[model samples]
Target: NAGVTQTPKFRILKIGQSMTLQCTQDMNHNYMYWYRQDPGMGLKLIYYSVGAGITDKGEVPNGYNVSRSTTEDFPLRLELAAPSQTSVYFCASRPRDNEQFFGPGTRLTVL
Candidate 1:
Protein backbone atom coordinates (compact mmCIF):
# COMPACT_ATOMS: atom_id res chain seq x y z
CA ASN A 1 0.00 0.00 0.00
CA ALA A 2 1.09 3.53 -0.65
CA GLY A 3 1.86 4.73 2.83
CA VAL A 4 1.36 8.33 1.86
CA THR A 5 1.22 10.10 -1.50
CA GLN A 6 1.02 13.62 -2.81
CA THR A 7 0.08 14.88 -6.26
CA PRO A 8 1.77 17.32 -8.62
CA LYS A 9 5.31 16.71 -7.48
CA PHE A 10 6.10 20.16 -8.76
CA ARG A 11 4.03 23.28 -9.40
CA ILE A 12 4.51 26.94 -10.27
CA LEU A 13 1.98 29.55 -9.22
CA LYS A 14 1.77 33.24 -9.78
CA ILE A 15 1.36 35.54 -6.84
CA GLY A 16 -2.23 35.44 -5.59
CA GLN A 17 -2.99 32.23 -7.42
CA SER A 18 -4.37 29.35 -5.45
CA MET A 19 -4.05 25.59 -5.59
CA THR A 20 -4.86 22.48 -3.64
CA LEU A 21 -2.24 19.90 -2.74
CA GLN A 22 -3.67 16.44 -2.47
CA CYS A 23 -2.57 13.83 0.04
CA THR A 24 -3.66 10.28 0.61
CA GLN A 25 -2.55 7.26 2.53
CA ASP A 26 -3.38 3.58 2.57
CA MET A 27 -2.28 2.76 6.08
CA ASN A 28 -5.63 3.62 7.67
CA HIS A 29 -3.87 6.14 9.83
CA ASN A 30 -5.98 8.42 11.95
CA TYR A 31 -3.52 11.29 12.11
CA MET A 32 -2.40 13.37 9.13
CA TYR A 33 -0.24 16.43 8.85
CA TRP A 34 0.99 19.01 6.38
CA TYR A 35 4.41 20.59 6.61
CA ARG A 36 6.58 22.92 4.58
CA GLN A 37 10.33 22.91 4.24
CA ASP A 38 12.16 26.00 3.16
CA PRO A 39 15.72 26.01 1.98
CA GLY A 40 18.09 25.74 4.93
CA MET A 41 15.22 25.33 7.36
CA GLY A 42 13.57 22.45 9.12
CA LEU A 43 10.04 21.35 8.34
CA LYS A 44 7.33 23.60 9.70
CA LEU A 45 3.88 22.29 10.43
CA ILE A 46 1.13 23.90 8.41
CA TYR A 47 -1.96 21.96 9.30
CA TYR A 48 -3.03 18.68 10.80
CA SER A 49 -5.96 16.38 11.45
CA VAL A 50 -6.40 13.94 14.24
CA GLY A 51 -9.17 12.15 12.42
CA ALA A 52 -12.01 12.60 9.96
CA GLY A 53 -13.89 15.86 10.58
CA ILE A 54 -11.24 17.11 13.01
CA THR A 55 -8.67 19.55 11.63
CA ASP A 56 -6.63 22.26 13.27
CA LYS A 57 -4.34 25.08 12.26
CA GLY A 58 -0.67 24.49 12.74
CA GLU A 59 2.36 26.70 13.22
CA VAL A 60 2.30 28.06 9.69
CA PRO A 61 -1.35 28.03 8.70
CA ASN A 62 -1.87 31.67 7.89
CA GLY A 63 -2.07 31.25 4.11
CA TYR A 64 -3.40 27.74 4.02
CA ASN A 65 -6.34 25.62 5.06
CA VAL A 66 -7.16 21.95 5.31
CA SER A 67 -10.02 19.52 5.82
CA ARG A 68 -10.16 15.89 6.79
CA SER A 69 -13.30 14.17 5.65
CA THR A 70 -11.96 10.61 5.62
CA THR A 71 -9.23 8.52 7.12
CA GLU A 72 -7.17 8.33 3.95
CA ASP A 73 -7.16 11.86 2.66
CA PHE A 74 -6.20 15.32 3.82
CA PRO A 75 -5.93 18.13 1.31
CA LEU A 76 -4.13 21.40 1.85
CA ARG A 77 -5.55 24.51 0.17
CA LEU A 78 -3.60 27.67 -0.41
CA GLU A 79 -5.91 30.66 -0.50
CA LEU A 80 -3.56 33.25 -2.00
CA ALA A 81 -0.18 32.07 -3.01
CA ALA A 82 2.80 34.23 -2.23
CA PRO A 83 6.53 34.13 -2.69
CA SER A 84 6.92 33.37 0.97
CA GLN A 85 4.92 30.23 0.41
CA THR A 86 7.33 28.80 -2.12
CA SER A 87 8.64 25.66 -0.52
CA VAL A 88 8.46 21.92 -0.55
CA TYR A 89 5.26 20.62 0.95
CA PHE A 90 5.16 17.27 2.65
CA CYS A 91 2.24 15.14 3.75
CA ALA A 92 2.60 12.68 6.58
CA SER A 93 0.52 10.14 8.44
CA ARG A 94 0.93 8.06 11.53
CA PRO A 95 -0.93 5.49 13.56
CA ARG A 96 -0.84 5.46 17.31
CA ASP A 97 2.62 4.52 18.62
CA ASN A 98 3.92 4.30 15.07
CA GLU A 99 6.46 6.41 13.26
CA GLN A 100 5.03 8.91 10.83
CA PHE A 101 5.20 8.11 7.14
CA PHE A 102 5.92 10.96 4.77
CA GLY A 103 4.95 11.59 1.17
CA PRO A 104 7.50 12.29 -1.54
CA GLY A 105 6.52 15.93 -1.34
CA THR A 106 5.22 18.68 -3.64
CA ARG A 107 7.60 21.45 -4.65
CA LEU A 108 5.82 24.77 -5.09
CA THR A 109 7.29 27.91 -6.60
CA VAL A 110 5.40 31.16 -6.43
CA LEU A 111 6.47 33.75 -8.93
Candidate 2:
Protein backbone atom coordinates (compact mmCIF):
# COMPACT_ATOMS: atom_id res chain seq x y z
CA ASN A 1 0.00 0.00 0.00
CA ALA A 2 0.98 3.61 -0.37
CA GLY A 3 -0.04 4.49 3.17
CA VAL A 4 -0.48 2.85 6.53
CA THR A 5 -2.42 -0.41 6.50
CA GLN A 6 -3.47 -2.61 9.43
CA THR A 7 -4.47 -6.27 9.33
CA PRO A 8 -7.33 -8.08 11.00
CA LYS A 9 -9.90 -5.32 11.10
CA PHE A 10 -11.59 -7.02 14.10
CA ARG A 11 -10.67 -9.54 16.75
CA ILE A 12 -12.07 -11.22 19.85
CA LEU A 13 -9.89 -12.37 22.70
CA LYS A 14 -10.27 -13.89 26.08
CA ILE A 15 -8.69 -12.54 29.22
CA GLY A 16 -4.92 -13.07 29.30
CA GLN A 17 -4.77 -13.86 25.61
CA SER A 18 -2.23 -12.34 23.31
CA MET A 19 -2.00 -11.08 19.75
CA THR A 20 -0.04 -8.84 17.47
CA LEU A 21 -1.59 -6.10 15.40
CA GLN A 22 0.25 -5.76 12.14
CA CYS A 23 0.97 -2.45 10.43
CA THR A 24 2.76 -1.61 7.22
CA GLN A 25 3.42 1.51 5.24
CA ASP A 26 5.07 2.38 1.96
CA MET A 27 5.64 6.12 2.19
CA ASN A 28 9.09 5.71 3.73
CA HIS A 29 8.01 7.71 6.73
CA ASN A 30 10.61 7.95 9.42
CA TYR A 31 8.19 8.04 12.33
CA MET A 32 5.61 5.45 13.34
CA TYR A 33 3.14 5.25 16.22
CA TRP A 34 0.69 2.89 17.86
CA TYR A 35 -2.37 4.17 19.63
CA ARG A 36 -5.53 2.83 21.20
CA GLN A 37 -8.94 4.45 21.48
CA ASP A 38 -11.52 3.29 23.92
CA PRO A 39 -15.17 4.06 23.47
CA GLY A 40 -15.91 7.73 24.07
CA MET A 41 -12.22 8.44 24.72
CA GLY A 42 -9.41 9.96 22.78
CA LEU A 43 -6.52 8.06 21.31
CA LYS A 44 -3.72 7.05 23.67
CA LEU A 45 -0.25 6.48 22.35
CA ILE A 46 1.22 3.11 23.16
CA TYR A 47 4.57 3.14 21.45
CA TYR A 48 6.53 4.85 18.72
CA SER A 49 9.77 4.74 16.80
CA VAL A 50 11.78 7.33 15.00
CA GLY A 51 13.30 4.78 12.68
CA ALA A 52 14.21 1.18 12.34
CA GLY A 53 16.04 -0.31 15.33
CA ILE A 54 14.81 2.50 17.59
CA THR A 55 11.65 2.63 19.67
CA ASP A 56 10.23 4.26 22.78
CA LYS A 57 7.23 4.12 25.06
CA GLY A 58 4.44 6.65 24.73
CA GLU A 59 1.53 7.75 26.93
CA VAL A 60 0.19 4.23 27.44
CA PRO A 61 2.76 1.49 26.85
CA ASN A 62 1.94 -0.88 29.60
CA GLY A 63 1.04 -4.47 28.64
CA TYR A 64 2.13 -3.81 25.09
CA ASN A 65 5.29 -4.09 23.05
CA VAL A 66 6.50 -2.86 19.66
CA SER A 67 9.32 -3.42 17.25
CA ARG A 68 10.49 -1.52 14.19
CA SER A 69 12.87 -3.74 12.31
CA THR A 70 12.48 -1.92 9.03
CA THR A 71 11.26 1.39 7.69
CA GLU A 72 7.89 0.07 6.59
CA ASP A 73 6.67 -2.15 9.44
CA PHE A 74 5.60 -1.33 12.99
CA PRO A 75 3.84 -4.14 14.79
CA LEU A 76 2.11 -3.83 18.17
CA ARG A 77 2.25 -6.88 20.40
CA LEU A 78 -0.12 -7.40 23.26
CA GLU A 79 1.57 -10.01 25.40
CA LEU A 80 -1.21 -10.52 27.87
CA ALA A 81 -4.38 -8.94 26.70
CA ALA A 82 -6.78 -7.63 29.31
CA PRO A 83 -10.30 -6.37 29.46
CA SER A 84 -9.01 -2.87 29.87
CA GLN A 85 -7.00 -3.37 26.71
CA THR A 86 -10.09 -3.73 24.63
CA SER A 87 -10.22 -0.89 22.18
CA VAL A 88 -9.66 0.13 18.60
CA TYR A 89 -5.97 0.18 17.76
CA PHE A 90 -4.55 2.53 15.19
CA CYS A 91 -1.25 2.66 13.37
CA ALA A 92 0.14 5.91 12.09
CA SER A 93 3.16 7.16 10.24
CA ARG A 94 4.58 10.50 9.19
CA PRO A 95 7.60 12.06 7.61
CA ARG A 96 9.61 14.72 9.34
CA ASP A 97 7.47 17.85 9.78
CA ASN A 98 4.66 16.27 7.82
CA GLU A 99 1.13 15.27 8.71
CA GLN A 100 0.49 11.77 10.01
CA PHE A 101 -1.02 8.97 7.91
CA PHE A 102 -3.26 6.56 9.81
CA GLY A 103 -4.51 3.03 9.32
CA PRO A 104 -8.14 2.07 9.14
CA GLY A 105 -8.02 0.71 12.73
CA THR A 106 -8.32 -2.70 14.37
CA ARG A 107 -11.20 -3.29 16.72
CA LEU A 108 -10.39 -5.69 19.57
CA THR A 109 -12.73 -7.03 22.19
CA VAL A 110 -11.58 -8.82 25.33
CA LEU A 111 -13.94 -10.85 27.44
Best by TM-score: 1
lDDT of each: 0.95, 0.94
Error of 1 at 83 (Å): 0.6
TM-score of the candidate numbered 1?
0.98
Give the 10-residue window scoring lowest on summed lDDT in candidate 1: 56-65
- Please identify model 2 stretches exceeding 4 Å from their true place: none
Against the hidden reference, what TM-scores do the models get?
A: 0.98, 0.96
lDDT of 2 by residue, 22-94 (tens): 9999999999999999878899999999999999999999999999999999999999989999899999999
lDDT of 1 at 41: 91
Give the number of the best model, judged by lDDT: 1
